[model samples]
Target chain A: MAKFKKSALKENDGISAPETTSIAAISKIKEKRRQKKSTSDLVKAILNGNITALSQAITLVESKNSEHLEQANAIIKACLPHANKSVRIGITGVPGVGKSTFIESFGSYLTNIGKKVAVLAVDPSSSITKGSILGDKTRMEDLVKDKNAFIRPSPSGTSLGGVARKTRESIILCEAAGFDTIIIETVGVGQSETAVHSMVDFFLLLKLAGAGDELQGIKRGIIEMADAIAINKADGKNLKQAKLAKVEFNRALHLYPVKTSNWQPKVMTCSAIENEGIEAIYSMILEYKKLTIDNNYFYSKRNQQNKFWLIQTIEEQLKNDFFTNSKIKIELEQQLELIENNKTTPFVAAEYLLGLKT
Target chain B: MAKFKKSALKENDGISAPETTSIAAISKIKEKRRQKKSTSDLVKAILNGNITALSQAITLVESKNSEHLEQANAIIKACLPHANKSVRIGITGVPGVGKSTFIESFGSYLTNIGKKVAVLAVDPSSSITKGSILGDKTRMEDLVKDKNAFIRPSPSGTSLGGVARKTRESIILCEAAGFDTIIIETVGVGQSETAVHSMVDFFLLLKLAGAGDELQGIKRGIIEMADAIAINKADGKNLKQAKLAKVEFNRALHLYPVKTSNWQPKVMTCSAIENEGIEAIYSMILEYKKLTIDNNYFYSKRNQQNKFWLIQTIEEQLKNDFFTNSKIKIELEQQLELIENNKTTPFVAAEYLLGLKT
Candidate 1:
């Protein structure tokens, strides 16, 4: 294990460093990168598969620092041709379903098989509290130590769904960086899980054996989107219960129409802690890849996901822009008061507000 | 019982007619009523509290017919001062949890006690299919026929959460109609339940006994927001299991912080089919009302709900405007194609499409 002193780690090249010069240099380079024929440069880096540059470029796109966005656009344009080659997997489960533990074990398995893996954690905790564990690297210490693995925790300070947009952009960067497997792990199954699922190629759901609350899962529709379900902690005393859960889940999954991919949704049991059945899971993924690629469904699915992301991004930005506009603020406040007073119906207030805009 | 054919009903009153002539006549009469604005007229109307007029007003608000919407706004404004007197209760449960049965029994109990009861259903399923068991009068056949009970099924054609907005508007109409107890029944427990919950004074979650889906409920957080939980089908062999489930739910409810209203959530078992425990449910609601009103939390909570609806309405309109614009449509298609070809990243595509507006 390589350990460095906190002071040493705070040096220019270290993780904790302020890196005033490099920060300044990066900004300057970004500005210059903006002025140059950025599209061509972006194209070059993306074709050459530079992951760091791709990630930095994505950050520029997501940044509130408006000045860097244009340059980021150029870089994305350059990288466009090399993107969409890898499998984008979104994994979700309940809070205590051992999501991180499963990812750690699963991710380590992928790395050992000569695959470059990137894990991005998309925590849905509110930005204000800053309470997210972002414990991917901590949980998957072995994978983090491997040269073939790259793990990034949830980027703090954004909406749960908004964090997913950044993660999607980061995936392109990881692919350009030579990672073949990109796994996005969301904290729990909810609206955020749906958001992540919409942006990925394969959606995996992890479950615990004998979840005392089965109806909760059915109501949320988490099981419906799942392409594959793995009942984790399926060892020792839990084995029979895990088998029973697998059967129950299979019955539920049957209710959904066959997915567009035409692949029969699969359910299996695994012990992330015991590192058992990890190889079978990988084999299933490979089978899925071969089946989809043979039918030319892989490229088409990615295309659809990209379009979904495009529209979702536009909708989110437009919402923020309209609500945050200085001009609409007063009228909105007044209308809210009217609504509170029961002097105006919401529909009427909405119409009046929109009329004000025109 | 009063029975009238659709045509006969339409002929009796100008407001019920679908023809332009009757619509014009109703509008003219409404205009005259608006201009007079006599103090006696206002007081008489408030004191009398016509339930039929209130029902018609709510229909006008939910109607897609643009002219009806204007009339609805006028009616709501006139009735505003008389509103806010009702004890608004929102009840939600997973499909087949006997939501309608509970409402039927509960509404009957209230009406029998000299309280006028109005039941409105918010069905998200109406949005996509436009095919709903509208006015599921059959589900509450007895209550529907009761002179003191009013039953309105879901209004068709709107988004999931958006449907609840109309229901909220209808609740105000119901209150003005002199219905002192208004129960808003949601068809399912999902996102729509949250919408119903935010607009009501008290929210009740119904569950089945011995179904063993408790873990599933926790995952979705439906049980968390519940002000009161009732394990239905508590008669017969399931009675013991219902009691056990109530104990488990009570423990789970304790994990949530005391609500802002300072009301301790309660759990009970009921047999809605047998009409047992309905009175107990009513008494619990009354207790909640008295406590919150004395603490000055009741009106304040309603005010917050009104504000939430106002902002939500504006946001929905803005999104609709952006998506429906002819100019945006053309550019959106072009950017989607660019994304499909991998010629642009989704973030860049969004920025470009939005930038085109300027």
Candidate 2:
């Protein structure tokens, strides 16, 4: 370790002939080494299914500090080769649809069946200035206590894009730690569902029984994105209504154009509290996985998602940098004012604001 | 005209003196004067509702010649003050859903009510190397012959964005030429429907009656964008099924979340050849217009759309510029290969390709 450190420092000295042996610089190098060694240890531990290391690595990934982000990147780089072995599933539901309870039930069932399950969340709305639905952390008590079940709450206070980036990287860490089934839970109301859907192999939406489907949050775009719908809380008095909803949801799904995946989205009923039909939903996911794998869509879809995220991240960061430029911000505001007053068409205004000739 | 031309050319003399009266320069000035006089005359004639001038201006807007583009820009700038007076409606349907025939029937109804109508096509599919669906021209025979109606076919062989830009500018020209009602038609299968939806005050979709509603072309996103649906070909034995389809559609729409406009989209059945329900559909548009305008949503929605298009146009162009760059293309392909091989995560790969130390 000392020899390697000396060689690395000497290479830096070769670039800049400053202070390879100075006390101040030496202390800084020692501090960096301490942080780096911990990150390396974390990766090693995580690969051995050490849950504590997994949690610490995730905390680093979710940290807003620059130093933590660098170390998190290093840990993620080491974990990448060990990831992508899990079947990722995204689950979403409205606030009252019992997503947490369902996940707890579902997670416990998977663990009982000898599957190591990791449950993560992408909830940007927790950052909303209004009251956030504090549902994930407190609702999954059983899963939190299970040795084979891991539950992580959504990272608080960030944009959906930021939260998505963190949770997605954390997925790699979880997978590297040997979790075979990964579930990404999101609230159906926000743009987070789209982000979750992009990273998951199967997307499931949970809905309540009855005409409550008319709730103002479940948009057609979300419904169309679902690979399956589980009508939750379908025990006892609500059983008939839940069955009816399943039929209606099936018909509604049929009205949609055929999905590109060629997999017809199924609707099922499950009472997470009663532990009814939870096994059926898992079976459905396995069926979808088997079907997609047979057709090579599993690998192809992952490849497409990787490319999608690559371009999306690049474009989004580029846009952020451009928009945050002080000059661009002032000019953009002026152009928007011009458009509002009808001085120019939006396209012409954009061209002008972008420094192109009129 | 001669006096203005001489003075305009002489402004160059105010800056430089050498070529003020040279024969070659004088002849070129005269040639420019001839073109400028005709463009000004074309604008004058269009403002007087001359169909021939209207046709010529649209041709210029659709042209690829650099000189024609400059003139088109000048014409569009001049026409802007006289535009934005029309209620622009976007109509979309599958190729066989009888969009042109419905427009023909609807246009004739409007013309009979003393409203001048202009129908414009946005068909990017013609650019496909496969045989184009040339249905617009021949399907609207009656409207083509009507004095108060102007039917312009799609600008052939361009992208959806290019075609949208052309059709949007053409609507301005048509509005300036006294067309109080403009119908922008798009085939629903492609991304053109979104483009059409962006520019129009109201969006109408035409659907056929049958199980073919599950056809892969009609994406749910497009359906969600519709402000109204007219089930066409309700004249024959399809009438009963069409009525049933309307009820089903209304119910299906209810299952989706409410739109921000706060105006519930309406569905109605219509028969183009029989002219059944044509006027009722028009009445629905007026009612929607009244409600939205009363609730102040119409203005707000239009503003939102303008802002959306401005940002969308800029981002898409920026992406095109970046992806088309020689350096970025090669680097992007390499990063994609790395991602496909699981050597690096997409976000990290993107960062490296973008020149960041990941």
Candidate 3:
């Protein structure tokens, strides 16, 4: 028995479902529609706070079509001024940590408090399997039905960098469409966490009780990046354990250096299903916002994140250019072979490849 | 009093001397001599275990002259056949953590036990100030005077990437010159650690007693990168506190996720001046080496590191090509300004630059 049930909730809907097109298929359909829509008309609707237009614009951003690139750029530029006003929060947890359950409850809670919430996931692993999105949608039924909340599953069939870029652009579209709070959800297992961390204003980590070797359960750098850690599934029998976990977490957090934000990362316990501690978590986020804003760290961090992603994007493109080069690919293999055989040092080999670019 | 007295040993030497021209200037004079030496002559001398030629070739590697590049590459190519037999070790600690004292003692101990130790420092920060190199050489009196040991200070007036390349190339030259042990040292405060970590077979971090807020002094990912953490200055009155710090470090390390190497990082108390715990630290490294070599992890890890540097080097060169472009440089600033004003997303800005490149 895991501390929190994630996939277990998917099977609890009590009915065998009929065949449905996967999120990947849904993306392809949207991709088809994106080509038919004019960039100006689509951007106009998105800027006018139309959710449908915002969704389509995001689809265009996620599309692989060469024709969609210019259009996606145009829409993002049009929506830029309308974006960045929202509190962009990144949430992550390992499987069985009840991340979906927590988000469903938290998203609904935000909407109830007169906030327009958008829940988007960055699942680069799903890019290969094309799985998790369908599971995510089923677990998020309550929030899916809530009119004030929008739950978009992870975009599939691309690299982490590509998926992250799409999700980041989608945040802009959602913010422009009047969603005041954007929740970027990612599995705690991968590079997606860092991607989400770089784009969001606040990064949240969800953990389970019992102290369960937190180091083993979550990825190495994930804990370090978290702005706050919520010990979820802290209800009834698990409440005491959850409270102990809070103490344990506080100790662990203190071991880390002071974060660049200067705000100490808060650790708290909550039961998403019981709706306990949900308000406290929201209040924590607000408190963080107040502190960072008061210290001018909020805007500075956002700008820093912006600059980070810009450089990251450029580096990604540059890497792709070099690796994707037909000649360089062949040359790289030869250089690696030479390095392995101790015939050439890596630096000299790298120089040869750089020389080849001319 | 601090847990360690690094500069105390220096003061004990009892000599306040006039400022001398730095090691970097000495490198340039050697670089001029390197131009006259034939590549074959240099390689022959290096392969015959001549320290002077090895140093000269390294100076050529560190040289900025375009003429030196061809000769440097040629020398490296000639030496590659004889290199890669040594065990490369990386050591790091904050400024006051007795790094120099520890290294001095450790290097001398290795020489006493019939090991040819090559001590090299990777100080990217030193490149900026053009300091620390002379200080390091002076502090390492015992090791510097040892005929069996070779010590090189950090190369100055270059980017970290450039310095790293020079240092890595120097490792090959040193190994070819029959130095069976290579120690790459770096300040505990910068990007140099990651560079050192990738090139070395083992990474060691030196810490002080009483916990003393390690997180504040060291980078976050660095602790995770350490294969062993030695609490230096564990002597006299500091012994109990050092033991306490050893326990604390172990506990803090256990809070993080497991490493890919499947090796548990060891924490131990050591006294450099007292020459205590030195053998245990060395034994731990040998034990690790034995285990890894037995499991074939040693070779596999080396190959992985080799591939990492190769790819990393290519990426650095690619980024330099794009970023150093006069047009892209100007465009990048404009795009960054737009991103700051929230007039365009980072992805869109990156795309425009990519478009311009094409």
Candidate 4:
């Protein structure tokens, strides 16, 4: 309804290249192009410390498409030589335990100390809950903005095995991209902790003081797997309870047999929110690393972990091949019914099924 | 020698058909015949509560000959309908924890109460140690001599899986032979406890009093799986220590999350040597059985166990076939070396090997 400029009406304004639209959409397209790079190119870029290339390579590794499998393998194979140089630490705690905040604070501290930190998660429940943990970058606001840190959500998959495999491969890529410190986070609710434990050099469990029934909610065998336990929220009125909890945990941990590493598991108090006691935790880790390296347990443990993954992957695939067979699937249900009716023993049923496979 | 009776060596004294020599060897041959019965005949004999046939069937189950596989399967299938009628109890303890004595006392108690008892063992180490456990039935002398009790030594196998399978099948034969109570014993040192736990209706851990560290010698997760812990050697001066251990263990047990069985695990003190507290243990088992049955956990747990075994057998065979493959064995070593040198990720290596298999 207002006055129009006469020059605009003249139509001589030669279609000024459709005003560069949606920067976010363009960047996403760019990302896709980056991820579609040749396997060798991606590996070369990753080895040169290119974060975008590292992320792209991880996407390829996590891809369910059959076509991506070979490329992903090639990238991992090429990147393998540059990997194994990082200090891989696994962090685990139950849901309301402020895992994101802990990782953010801990990760920032590592970066401040001139370390390149890469954070990844293994949440088996993510597939069902559509990534309930680490899915939102907002949860780690400062770390997300930190140029020296890389944050990634849990990979979505139908099974924990699939997700764990992807995360492990991504660790290699991150390490190749010059990530000196890798933090793997997992919810301490299921078998995901075991997978994470097998992949990390050290495991840290976070706990809150005065949760009532200190050990009641802990999963079985978790304490045995931890290299250290940090009683978080050790500030304000909670400080005394946290210190007491630390002593109790220390006592309980000693009840376990001495670890083969000859390093005793330790317990300490920390405030991930207030960022208190963070340096001490890192110092403790450095001490542990020094001791383990001196004792040769560090290298030996990595070798053992690699061997475990090799066997685990083979077994998982073997199971997938067998259980997914159409005929076997149909026959399995029938055998289960037979088991229910007590018409067949499980061993006999298994033998029959195995014969059917052949 | 000159004083021997003339009838002993007379060739034609009374035209005696060569006096039968070596009565022991002749009886052994008769025992062999009893073991080699046809599948249907063995099933019928087992169903008719014939202990000899039950033992023979168990031997067939334990045999390594491929020819016996089909026969064993048939016997198990025939026995299936009559199985699952007994209360299967698993007992485990360290070597010096009086496992045999406890079984002798408790098993005798069951038989004396008009309950037919069958004792079997799963000691994977037995194959290597020539069965340090149960191999010598002389350990359970009184129970062995009881007509109502049948004691079978641990079946020896190179793998725990194989030994566990044999013991599981033997349970079927024993149940079909009218054994209303089955007692499975295992050395508490290895994975045998887990194997035993999967198959039993109740798991009882035997522990000595005042072992200095009440929980130190326990393998990880063993206490979590126990339905009850009996602090043995509670007689004499050890009584006070055993009571203290009971209190300590009870406190530790409460720290664990309630079991899915909805029944809290119990800790008690007993003296196997003095034949004290044996009745209390039996009462505890009875109480557990009643609760589980009333809540329907007993039936559900059995079903889950059957399914577990079925899958376990299939997976074990799958691994066996893969590892034993000539090509895979050669490639596996190469891949392992590649892993050592960090030339390939385990996932990538596993994929290449799996591809080669096809």
Candidate 5:
């Protein structure tokens, strides 16, 4: 019964030890200094590539306080000139596809090749799950510790639109901090992929070799949006299937019309954990960059994205205002019931509701 | 050239014969009576299967006159209980894919099987080309004369949304007129296909076997929407290629996840000009109807589509109202210019514009 003995009680780290009492005073002074910093001082620090300033600016951007929002908008406007210099890449895959591993290996490779990398996420479900995807730093332990890399979990928000807006602004902050490459990671499940695709220059879909067809479980319209597909975990017993998947995907990709960028989307096999094939993927992206830039699509696409976002924001706000109106919400339910009973058509009901809003 | 000389001394139909002058008096009286008839009477006549009344009601729906729209809404509300009884099938194909011939053959089959067919179109380009798709009665000469069939060209509207609304309203008129099969046809280019897809129970894509791969010229996102793909012009030398295309398309269709309808989309070869394979297509639709009905998806899907239309109309109207505001328009341009100069972000610009509107 006594095969194991009880270990000695350890000091609780949750409670501050007596010797660390002086640290509290330093924290209060630091907080006071942060409060005293002006908007211009924050902007200058961010432009000077100060990581702490960048993090603080992003926090302001993600804040709910109207005062913070005003400051954040001012900071972003100041940083706008320095943005759009980075190659923003969006990477997405299902839960078990090793997205963090891929990013760790690929991002580390970028830093090694003398590129500054920033990783952000746009998980719409982060609010409910409380940032499940990248909340744990141990998932990408090495990349998190790398000096040239900045990793931020998805910002929690009440809606995908809010979260996407935060991540997009964070991208500007990251870019102004002298990062040349930005990676936005979204889970393969929701509307987040489309939001990510709109903001990024190149979209890479991460996949795993299934037991059967390689294209079995792809979300609709995703292959069309992807600039490349990387089959992660192509190591040990999975290598052969991954190669076959690459060939299959290549054939499938050819069936699509030539992209507007005139750069054919590429498919490759990579072992993120084993650190295999990451460099080839990077070269492929660079090649795509060269082609799209030469063809004048890079700048034009970014301009289109800007216009799209402007219209998208306005339309979303318009819809929110209408649907959230006290009278419209109640009358909308009645119209739907009328629609259910076939007493009114959707068009007629919509007209009635619009009149109510006015 | 002499043989082709103008036919000698034919009485001019445009000027009318002297004896027909009496008929003009009767036309005036009939016009007066039509004007005097109330919306309820028009609704009653449509429910009684009066083709003239149905056509007049649809014209009102397509009219831009405010008074006509009011009357149209009244008639539609009265007819709403009689609508939603027919099966709506959407047919789309690129120009020169023989869309008219396919509809002629397929629609005639439905009529022969004792079904009343109403053929409508949603050509967004109709405004520019003056209703190019079905404006010519000769395109479906036989069907145009069939008492069991009602055909309407795409309504000419400045916006696709307006045209789509007219067609949708006309569908109600046709259904109330006792048409059991509603066929909505759209050209394969632009946004018309999506509009048509949202309104129909079954979406059929018409394709021609290309010189190379059969999938070479398909517009993006179309194959995923298709419930069936019929390869036309398969009577001549194209037959062999059409069969090969069927096999290729079958494989491609399998790659898509199962539809919410739980019906596997089919690929078939049909010679519309030769009138072959028409009945088989009908049988396939009946089978799909049976499966969906058994699974309770048929009613659920219709309900979902109704809710979708209601929300869609509200959103479109909201955007229209916002963008059409004169003050917002000028400010929007200014904000865009600022965005181009990197002085403002899309989010901030949108906020400023929205604030100005309020």
Candidate 6:
């Protein structure tokens, strides 16, 4: 992870008067291009897979600069036809589960076999610091240099689910760009994991050899969602424990009814550091894909996930809008204080705040 | 629990009109109520503490019937001024933990001490099967017989968390009605438990001894949220394992950071069947409340819960609105079939659906 000095990318500089005017000019040019370009132009670009335009378009969607949102929507509409061809995989584990390392090894194996890979991180922690170690780009030196590999770090935002509103938009951009495998790396475990799982085609849970406490911390609801569990760091003395965990997870997976796809979930072990068993992990995913496809689960799962994202996105936006209202904000603090002082209950405070907005 | 046949409730036939018209009337009534009723009017009624009105108001809030919602909102607004005086306690356990039996015995103890108690269940099961069980009010026969105590089986026809919402609202109405304590019984051992915990002052997790696989199924997130753990059925040959599980859970709890509240979470043993150690559990909750109040955490926690509920309610409403959109629904089903056929991916389908709406 490349740690950029604060001096390197001054945040305030982007909005300086001269820069602002240039940005305005660029915005005008973008607007003209948007007005003139047919959807076919955009689709062709996406199909020929122009990476820079795709990235720029994704940035536009993520941008708080409202001016860019329209353009972003247009670009996405144009690219939609060529998108949704890839297998979107979501991987999660606790901090020490070696998520990055596993992704690096696993991603490398896929690319080595001529598959184009795109690795994205969903880091909720990035929201506070706005500085993420994984997003630094320099961390995955090998993957970054590979012709078939694409690595994008978490976007800086408040949403814990890695990526952003545009991440889903970007997945289409990636698929359109000819990247057949999109791996979403979420900050290990918690609510954010659920966010990632909801959007992906396949869900992989990475676990350590002895995550007894972790196993307890992860809710059964989440466990039932995983399509496969891979015990990572299964080397040296921990191998036995990893195997044992695999057995335990396998048994736990059985308690759930057969999946809609009619395919049994699988558990495996791998050592990301050693790069051993990575291929087997890939094969397992392939087997799952095959089973799901044959059972007609692949398309249905994707459709459900799509519906989930659309609703999720709208819900998130509505929440943001509700909280951001100036009138609501002014009353919220006072109401919260009232609730704290026992002068009012939460139900009452909420009613009052909502009343103010309406 | 009383299992009144469906035939019995059907006799109240005229009450079964479609909710739209009634909901509209209730909404207007609620608005007029907000404008006219003084806090005293709301409180006076609650201090008289009518259980039927409280139950009806909660029903209004839970029902899709617009008219009832208006009245429910009005009642809640009026009751708001008098709510939150009681200690709200949340209890959850895996299925087969003898939850109903424990509540029956424990509730009887509270009433014996001259404390008016209200027990509400948040049913997580499906709505079709729920009404049958909703009639099973005979489970807590003793508590039901006690004029000072109220036992409400789970409210039927809502989402897993929906039941909790109704339960939380009911707690407010119960408190207004002068109940000294409100015990929320969860749907058991999963996401619903978290929903229950977020709304209460103290959270209790109940468990059975030697429930090996059952214990493993308990989500760690719920365990971490717990303020106390009780090993139910701790009175017989199972005593040894219950004690052992207590040790294990105690150690597990230690791994979590000390809760923000002053009290160190406690682990205890109880036999609901034998009616042993019931009072101790109540005392522990009282002690927790006292400690949190002394440390100034009582009001703060309530404030946080209020904020959480406000945001949660809005989000749920927003999602419901989005999914219920007629255009989105038609497009969604078509896209879902395409996805099932593997002709398109979720990302692409989402983009298409979102595009259609825009």
Give the candidate number with the greatest DockQ.
4
Q: Which has the better lDDT: candidate 1, or candidate 6?
A: 1
Candidate 2 segments whose C-alpha is farther than 4 A from its true place? A1-37, A128-136, A211-217, A254-262, A356-358, B1-38, B127-136, B211-218, B253-262, B356-358
lDDT of 1 by residue, B1-358 (tens): 2555546435544465466567778999989867733434533464477655555566677888877666666767777788888888988877788887888888888888899988887787764345444355688888888988878778765486557777877887788878888888876635777888887899998888756645443425576678999889999999998988888888777766778889999999999999988889888988999999999999999888877777777777777877788998998888888787778777777888788776
Residue-level lDDT tens digits of model 5 in A160-181: 8899899999999999999999
The candidate scoring highest on TM-score is 4
Task: Compute the lDDT for candidate 5.
Answer: 0.90
DockQ scores for all predicted structures: 0.34, 0.36, 0.44, 0.62, 0.56, 0.18
Query: How does chain A of every candidate compare to the true chain A by TM-score?
Result: 0.80, 0.85, 0.87, 0.89, 0.91, 0.79
Off by over 4 Å in 4: A1-36, A127-129, A211-213, B1-36, B211-213
Off by over 4 Å in 3: A1-41, A47-49, A127-130, A133-135, A212-216, B1-35, B127-130, B211-218, B251-262
Docking class of 4: medium
TM-score of 6: 0.75
lDDT tens digits by residue: candidate 6, A176-223: 789999998887534777777776888998888785643555544667
Candidate 3 lDDT, B64-112, residue by residue in tens: 8988878999998888888888889999887788888888888888899
Per-residue lDDT of model 2, residues A89-147, tens digit only: 99988778888889889999999999999998888876535433434357778888899
Q: What is the C-alpha lDDT of each candidate?
A: 0.76, 0.83, 0.85, 0.89, 0.90, 0.75
TM-score of chain B of 5: 0.90
Score candidate 6 by lDDT: 0.75
Model 2 clash pairs are: none
lDDT-superior candidate, 2 or 4? 4
Deviation in Å, model 2, residue A30 alpha carbon:
14
Quality class of the docking in candidate 1, CAPRI style: acceptable
How many clashing pairs per prediction, in order? 12, 0, 0, 0, 0, 22
In terms of docking quality, how is candidate 3 classified? acceptable
Error of 6 at A254 (Å): 5.0
Candidate ranking under TM-score, highest first, comes to 4, 5, 3, 2, 6, 1
What fraction of native interface contacts is shared by candidate 4?
0.88
